[model samples]
Target: MTDRRGVVAKRAEDLMPGVPYVRGWNRARQSASALADQLVLLGLDSDFPGLVADVNVVGDGLVQLGTVRPEAAELLATLIAAGLRAELHGTTAETPATARREAPAA
Candidate 1:
């Protein structure tokens, strides 16, 4: 049987799924900061703390969406997807400072 620590570790691994490649708009370097803030507001900060980062794609693309850690890729992708869908439904982004004010106190 696995130990308690092992079980918890395994669960964390399972909960952290794989990330998808999110491209299209919002890839511009200038947009990276806003993207990261969106991720944080969407509750992705628990998984990726730093913020949305601007990464260079190997091929021709205006922008790229990926995680520094393989595990975080999935959550990041989900966040982006949700954001896109929201925009499609006429959603507007909340400002970084505004989001911070609304975040649950630690």
Candidate 2:
């Protein structure tokens, strides 16, 4: 929750083919990959799985998480994994265990 500057600036008018999204870089939590394993969180075979909306590395140790659309708990998890941490912000928490039961991995 360092700063949502990126998230706040997102426009619903610029969504991708599959879902709307936002992108921003984190200065505090630098991801070896993307913020919050968003890719993995998105589940495999998803269109635009790891689409980052806005990204910026600033001077202060702060990672700005951008906006996300079709904002689902699953998608949020992925964003958080990239580097942005959200506390008490979970509403759609779905794990692989339940996923297997629902769609069973191929």
Name the TM-score of candidate 2: 0.27
For all candidates in order, the CA lDDT equals 0.45, 0.40
Query: Which has the greatest TM-score?
Result: 1
Per-residue lDDT value at 75 in model 2: 41
TM-score of each: 0.31, 0.27
The RMSD (Cα, Å) of candidate 1 is 12.9
- lDDT (tens digit, per residue) of candidate 1 on 22-106: 3422354457666656566665556555443332222111333443566466444544565587799898655445544454443
Stretches off by above 4 angstroms in model 1 are 1-29, 49-67, 82-106
Least accurate 10 contiguous residues by lDDT in model 1:
8-17
Which model scores highest in lDDT? Answer: 1
